[model samples]
Target: MHDFSWGQLVNPEFYIKLGGIYLVLFIIFAETGLFAGFFLPGDSLLFLSGIYSKELIQEIVFIKSDFLNVLLLSSLVSIVGIIGNEVGYWFGKKSGPYLYNRKDTIIFKKRYLFQAKDFYDKHGGGAIILARFLPILRTFAPIIAGIVQMNKGKYFLYNIIGSIAWSFLLIFSGHYLYKIFLNNLDFDLKKHIEIIVLIMVLVTTGPVLFKLFFKKKEGEDDNSI
Candidate 1:
């Protein structure tokens, strides 16, 4: 059996070297669809996938062209992401009423569902797309959409658009940016993967943290008054 380590779980390079493109796709699917997968490294994985697109793609299909490899990798990841969201939506739709009526468990809370509903009410369909860029929100957005019975046609459209945009932008940026730095600036992204991952995490999670902090403070202020 393969030994488990938190270090390996968080390291995108470990994933690439171990399972190559297939593992990357699975992580994207799980992170975007499964409630328990919120903590998985989606953004950094995609970025690193771009950086190592040639190697990852070659593992599955030998391709001499870097552009073709990245393109194929991005397209596959996008499709899997869309499928994952659909699965989350289906789960939420099927279990929506049950979730509302069910008592909160140690792991599940009714208030979270309520908060998702309220967020959807305020943001409408746009939340699906916007949530794609945010970490935890992306995982729950589709599920919430189902619980609230969002328009099926509208949700499907946004699902496709958001998945494609998110996958293509991050993966391509990683691949091309690495090339740019290496050729022009003499900086190698591979040598600085840790810093890159840290920046990606902060950049993606910063807004979520900011809102949570201020929201808590506002609640405290109101309680004091």
Candidate 2:
């Protein structure tokens, strides 16, 4: 954990730090904002990285580490997150139908796609925001949005709104929380990063597992049907 997190989360050198921000941005885009990015970290990492942004302002970017800067970084994260998701929507539109269902395993686990499709249908465009908070659903949200051929202008509007709310709330929350606790002495970088990483794993993965289980159960019922 010590060597694991670079200046992004804790402390480190120079050049590596520059790459981290872009990487985090890219992941946020690919994961929540993109199709295949469902495997990427969403809320948890957003929160953890949000905290790191505060630290970044204080040290790296030289952007006075104050509440004002907090707002700026938070807004930046949200904007980037939403932008990433929009790009993902395009990607999904380009590729989703061909991958909608498996030929051999039609009934294996169609619940996610079906649910995502329905949600996108009813909500119009706001599903983008809802999906940001839900990792597995985030992956499907944009794809489904595309599949439905949602109005491009409306989709962008909703995506920006959702991304701003979701990204700022979660990441800034993480940033503030980390600030409150870690500011004290006896700092534990490894423990801190480890906890954050663990949280990311759970936030990203736990829902996936639960969805898989429920879908499996649904599959069994369909088999019985």
Candidate 3:
């Protein structure tokens, strides 16, 4: 519930509160790029952060930099996320069976592996796009791809695509949405567009999750076959 009045988030002190947008970028990187990052707040936090940033842009005009700064910050974050995903993939590939079932871990073994495998089995590219929006899944999806020994070329492609789609979508959308409101001097200028984007993301993700879920269930049934 960032105050929509007087723009609290844009305060130079406030923007610096978490090192401005860079903090957001880093969090996105870790969440999207790292498997262990599944525990991090992804969607809700990003959404709220965006809403706050809207106020910042309007109330605090002197950001000490221009939109380029925001772009650079976001791009850096995207790189971090992508690299994190690769490393996480390597770890999952190396440690999936053991660490997954280890008493030290809280991950539900069957659930994690099942979703990963399911996504890998059916829609290879689709998982990357769909998972970009879904929390935790973004980090683990690529790692799962790596564990399963997905084609390196193909994996790289999907990874890049997902990273760009997810990273840009969130950062730019949040910033732009704020711009619209600030420009119009209205509090709810593009609430409809925001809602639409959210719906689109969910609508796009539904089939991927469903396919994975059902595929996993079928695989379980097949085990008894």
Candidate 4:
């Protein structure tokens, strides 16, 4: 087995280098479906998958065209993401009540689950789609859908739409934008991947953090006053 440091675990590039495309698919699966996967790098990993599309795609299949390879990779990732959500929904449906009474552990947090519940309540079925872009919410929204016993057909429809949109948008952005920078601006995303990943994390997780800390605290203060 390959030894992975904590830093390496968090780095999107390390995943690609360590296990290539297959590892990427597993990480996407875990992050989207498992409660313990809430902290995994989702958006940045998808973005980096685009940057390394050629190399990663070669592992599974040989494609002559770069665009087609990225497209194929994105499609595969979308399918895995959809399956992951299905697993999460099934888990929630089976043990929805137990989860509420379960205490927090290193990998599990009641707050994130509650946050997902509120998001689902407010947005109704749309939360499944919207939560695909949000970090913790994305991880738990499907589970919440199952917990509430959302219509199976409706959940499936939103799951497909959300997974496709999320996978295609981020992965394609990385692939095409990398080409644009290299050809036109003489910039290489691969060289500056650290900065790019950092930005992606901040952009994707910023709102969740803001709500968790600032907004929640403000509400507490208001209640106290």
Among the numbered candidates, top lDDT falls to 1
Question: How well does candidate 2 score on lDDT at residue 80?
Answer: 78
Q: For model 2, give the 10-residue run with minimal summed lDDT.
A: 7-16
lDDT of 3 by residue, 52-133 (tens): 5533343434455546544554465567667766776676677766645655346555565656677676887887667777
Error of 4 at 73 (Å): 0.6
Evaluate residue 183 in candidate 3 and report its C-alpha lDDT on the 0 to 100 scale: 75
Name the weakest run of 10 consecutive residues (lDDT summed) in model 1: 116-125
Alpha-carbon RMSD, each predicted model: 2.6, 5.4, 7.4, 3.8
Candidate 1 or 4, higher lDDT?
1
The lDDT values for all models are 0.89, 0.67, 0.61, 0.87
Candidate achieving higher TM-score, 2 or 4: 4
Local lDDT at 180 for model 2: 66
Q: Over the full model, what C-alpha lDDT does candidate 3 score relative to the true structure?
A: 0.61
Candidate of highest TM-score: 1
Error of 3 at 39 (Å): 3.5
Model 3: how far is 63 from its true place, Å? 8.7
- Candidate 4 per-residue lDDT, tens place, 130-222, comes to 889988888987877887666788789999999999999999999999999999999999998789878998998787888789988999999
RMSD score of candidate 3 (Å):
7.4
Q: Is candidate 1 or candidate 4 better by TM-score?
A: 1
Clashes of 2: 3
